[model samples]
Target: MSQHSENTPILEARNLIKVLGGNRVLDSVNLDIGRGRVKVLIGPSGAGKSTLLQCLNFLTPPDSGHILLEGREVNAGSKKELCSFRQQVGMIFQDFNLFDHLSALENVRVALMKVRGMSKLDATERAVAELKRVGLVDRAAHYPANLSGGQKQRVAIARALAMDPKVMLLDEPTSALDPELIGEVLTVIRALAQGGMTMIMATHQISFSASLADEFIFMEKGRIVEHGSPAELLGKGVGSRTQAFCAKISELTGEADGEFRS
Candidate 1:
């Protein structure tokens, strides 16, 4: 992997809070993630992982807190500024949010054409390259309905990469795939991790997360209860609630410490 430009934290969230239906989905969450580092977010179900990711990317506005990307904050002062920041932050979802009417190639090409204003030829070329990077070049013409779960997820990943985003947030990317298909999607993520992309990934893939993550955050009931390196979080054990939750998952999956290497 190439060296990270600088060790400075590229994004920061301070005192973030979110509420839905009189429930606190996020509470006073604070995080500082460095550039070119993989930050894995982990926990049991409904732990606010998705909420945190959405808030950071402005997909869901924080109820009371602020998000700073590459040092400057996202504020209501200017639409241009907000657009600029939003473009720099890309996201991937469990549902593989590709347009049903568009082919994989077209999906990737859309942002480059509309957002970056690249020519069709240039965008197509870039889209092809990114699809190849995700091991989906041959599937470029396939639409979401025609592709397998893992294939669709890979196309989604390629779509995000085509935008050349500065920060990528992945929310349970493999959860929707069949048991046999998860590996294909994880492989693409592994490649990206090896390339030193800055990411805030909300995952249940403990093995991959442990092996690739520069840091791990464990959330429970709308708050971050513990956080550390892969080895630290899964090696020495975790809090009582986290330990119980992970243990339960381990039972069903036969291996809960997901994509992380021992």
Candidate 2:
């Protein structure tokens, strides 16, 4: 088993709650992700997986709860602290939020310059390195409109990686791609996981989650109903609700056995 200390979690959420239109989206949700471990969030639609990720990064601050990064409380109320905190916690969205006008290289470079205050030359070098890491250095000059969905998302990943984030929050990184394109993005993510990058990902790709995650969490009605290793949760030992949900997802994706190549 992977070892982790109880006294410190790389990232943690305590009693996180969010209400939208008087409906509670996150009902006092709590979780802990250890350093260099990958945790995949899986559940039915509208189970608050995305909301939980957003709250963790303060993209959508929770109505109540505390967020701790490296055991230090993240005070969203303080501008300087929040900015620094956000820099250390990178978020990737399903929509591939690349600048329409900027080239892939510039997309990555701009963040390093603006956020980290790196010189233009230094930022460009760092950006090239990151794009290369995502296997998109050749497409450096392509703008978002010119690139395919997979390439665009790769650029987005490069942008986040350029910041040298301590924890990565990916909200369905492969959900927006075509079937053929999904593998390329998943390849990069798998590489990152293998390299021991700490991550919390919300995705419907059950096979990938099962194979790569250190722990799998099943959320429903904004609460974590079950959580365990892939061998336990995806095996015959899970509860009926979780098993039924997994079966349904498999039926929808046509990967009932949950076997997939990254």
Candidate 3:
């Protein structure tokens, strides 16, 4: 993993609250994500992990809160500001989100060309480099329909990386993939973590989370119930609720206790 000074936080959220249809989905959430560190958000379904990420990316503006990227506030109300913030904070969705008609290269290149306003040649070169980084260079010409689920997610990751984002937000990245396919995507993600890319991920892959995450934040009822290193959060001293949650996740993922490996 990339070495980083503990004092510098690349992204921070303060009192982030999001309400949808008269219900609070996120409640006074706060976090400081250090540069080059991997943070794993773990919780039961509908625990607001996805909503918090959406707020961080400005995909769904929070009802009330503030987000800071490299110490500058993200102004969600302004379109230009929101666009710039999004460029710095990339998002990887669960569904892959690749355009069906576009080749993997085009899917990655189009964003570089249109959003970053690069020339087609420049965008193509950058796109290919990102594809190579994600181990998808050989499949650059394949369309979404022609690629496997894992390949498509890698393309999506490549597309995000082409933006040169400071932070990546992944929401249930491997949930939709077949059991066999999940490994490929997880491998790519582990490589990214090892390369020191700052990331916050929500996933059901408890083993991967335990092995790779620098810190774990467990959410419940839209609040962070526990936040600490894997050993602390999964250790014997934690509350029963936290322990039970981790046990359930471990049971489901077939990961033994204290199986962390970086």
Which rank order by lDDT, best down to worst? 2, 3, 1
TM per candidate comes to 0.92, 0.95, 0.93
The best candidate by TM-score is: 2
Q: Regarding TM-score, does 1 or 2 come out ahead?
A: 2
Q: 1-262 in candidate 3: lDDT tens per residue?
A: 2344356589999999998887788999999898899999989998999999988987888888889887778778798988888998889999989989999999999989889999999999999999998899999999999999999999999999999999999999999999999999999999999999999999878767888999889899789988888877666656545567877877767776664322
Q: Residue 17 in candidate 2 has what lDDT?
A: 97
lDDT at 137, model 3 = 97
Candidate 1, 1-262: lDDT as tens digits: 2354365568889899999888899999999888788998889788899999988877788898888876677783477777778788779998998989999999999989998899999999999999989888899998899999999999999899888788899999999889899999888988888888889999877766778888888898899998877666565444444455555667678884542222
Q: Once model 2 is optimally superposed onto the true structure by TM-score, how far is the C-alpha of residue 164 displaced, in angstroms?
A: 0.5
Q: State each candidate's clash count.
A: 11, 0, 0
Candidate with the larger lDDT of 1 and 2: 2
